[model samples]
Target: MSVVAVLRLPLAVDLSGFVKLLQRMQVPHRVSEEAGEQVLWVPDEISEDVRSLYARFPAGDPDQQLELPASGRTSTRPGFVQQLKASPITALVLLSSLIVAAVTLLGENLETLRWLTFLEFRVVGDYIQFTPLGDSLAAGQWWRLVTPMLVHFGFLHIAMNGMWYWELGRRIEARQGGINLLGLTLLFSLVSNFAQYVFSGATLFGGLSGVLYGLLGHCWIYQLLAPNPAYHLPRGVLVMMLVWLLLCLSGLVSLIGFGEIANAAHVGGLLVGCFTGLLGGLFARRKMAL
Candidate 1:
């Protein structure tokens, strides 16, 4: 747990490129002002690696000395498109949400919504009536369980959710790997959708808000427990989300014409995400200790 100083330089020098390199390499580090100089601190064990890296491409003059591989060519960091290609799970989740939103806008609206939402069953007189999604599920369409997470009610809803998904999902994919992000997304979707169904009882509801809340909770708790810079979120962002959640649950959103928020799904997703994050953080700590 001890941090060792890896490099020190003038406070005026720009260290963005070098910092980005460290981030891309997944080397945990921190920068701080120390006695009129900027100090780079890293875990004690990685000091040698950091020093070796700096020796080859000194952070003191990052622009002039480019770090070349064995081929003597500068290594290019992946761009956004390249990142999307590398993180298939993050790409798939984002694409799925976008596709659903596009289809709902272009296709038959009611039909598309019905097809993607979570199903409910009701006893109507002497027979059991199933919702569109429920009927599809009964006929072996298994995707109904998770597709609800992609369904969006309006333009604003889809846009807001899409932005959050891109931001949070990519971070998880980058830091934890694509499979971990995919697993958490699926788990959050199922839990939140089921909770919403139970709370509302046969009502139609759909959006990525639940999953966003889940991602928020995951990152929030993971940062708290593990102290990783990658999972760090601003205090203001956390406070805003919590305030919005409280407002939704307090019925203020509906009263203010924002429509009914999926309060149950939000709460459900957050609780499950926090639990998952706690377990994941503990597992990571144990692994690091070993």
Candidate 2:
């Protein structure tokens, strides 16, 4: 059978532990060195499986001594630089969110935050004065459509959203590609932001929670349609997010001091996400059948 290179790591990187996992899984592969890089080749058919494993444990895990058919146990996690290289788009989003959070002082600094908010606003002595939506849009401020995803409101808000995005964004990016992931993210943000603006009505609100739900829905439905092991999410993860969504919609989360919940954005993002996943999974299923 023909083989393809699934990974190309720097010369200094070690995959001894990953190799052991491959051996345990009985995946046929070969490792070679070329021009100071380590290249891993596997059968073309199982390339996705092998690459998914490598992305999970780039340096391999040493503590996983148990023999499993296919395990996601970590040996030595990849270094920070390696992670950045592995998922640059995810890293960029997180970094941009961090910068926006800092500059906006968690949405306290209205002057700096106004540019990223969905609507234009002014600081009027401890209060905000919002410009009409039509005015802002007509002024060629198109970036406002999606920049709201970057303007988080609090520490816990950004933290939770960032963590979720990191988990879900990288999974899609690893399987599809950076461009696909970026496009999905932008689409999610645009829809979610607009939904929030319509439902909440010109008030101050911003976070990645809606987009996180989008990613979650994408992976959740995509896996169901295509049944790819790489896209499989834990049952507990699915339950937790769904429960949280329900609670947010019921207003319990907001009533309990977690702040106002963007129920419309979350629901809108999830709806669009499921639709996209259906389309994508159907296409992939068809391609595989051919």
Candidate 3:
């Protein structure tokens, strides 16, 4: 196969992330060391795509590293450490949820959970009363807007949401980048949280369900518009999620003793996610066309 040098960089610069990305995507490439630099070589036919990928992930990203086993060889499947390194934002969110779970005793500790809620609350005997949203905002509790995402009502709640997030979050971070994932998460949280508050009259509800739906919606629409392997989900995943959403909206899930469902939040997040995916996918498609 005819080869062409895609990039030549000083050894001090790390392209391991980029190399790993290529390997994950199964892009054919080779790395060789010259006198004082590392060179990335690829077949002439796919050099442009490799260059495009490099442009997208210069320096291999901050959280990504090229890992070698004790035998001085690369592993086909990355371990937990490597996965965590590659998706720091995802890991951070999961860790935050876990900590919140412990601190609030799975939402049983209302006093501790008050700080993370969208609105401050007071416990009155057997009832919990929430202050007006305006009161919290006026008091400069800005973090309250996004912090609710960290709160979990139960172990099962956090565990299920955490699993979905770990699966979806890493995919977004690996492809769209961490900053992109962070921005999307924040946006989804703000929109979905506010939607729930508006629709449910400031009830206490918290979980990553809304954000998970947003991530799913984003992937579904983005895959359609841009057609990238990273956004390509399994055949029934989208259907299953939508059906679950419908079940929640129908109040069937709540009837089964699953507690109150934040149907509004899920819907809000999904709408916003689809909108973002449309915008992002269109831009990506245009860029690729060019």
TM-score of each: 0.71, 0.77, 0.80
Model 1 per-residue lDDT tens digits across residues 1-290: 89878778898887777787776566799999989999889996566456656665555443544333434456787688877776788779878878988888722376566667677445578664666655677799787788889888777888888888888888787677788998999999999988998898777678888898999999888767666656778899899999999999999899999887899999999999998889887865554443
CA RMSD of all predictions: 9.7, 8.1, 6.1
Native-to-model Cα distance after best TM-score fit, residue 205 in candidate 3, in Å: 0.4
Which is the leading candidate under TM-score?
Answer: 3
What value of lDDT does candidate 2 attain over all alpha carbons? 0.85
Q: Give the per-residue lDDT digits (tens) of candidate 3, residues 160-189.
A: 999999999998887788999999999999
In model 2, which runs have C-alpha deviations exceeding 4 angstroms? Answer: 1-76
- Against the reference, the lDDT scores of all candidates come to 0.78, 0.85, 0.87
**TM-score preference between candidates 2 and 3, better one:** 3
- Candidate ranking under TM-score, highest first, comes to 3, 2, 1
Q: Going through the candidates in order, what is the number of backbone clashes in each?
A: 0, 5, 0
Residue pairs with backbone atoms closer than 3 Å in model 3 (clashes):
none
- How far does residue 124 in candidate 3 sit from its true spot (Å)? 1.7
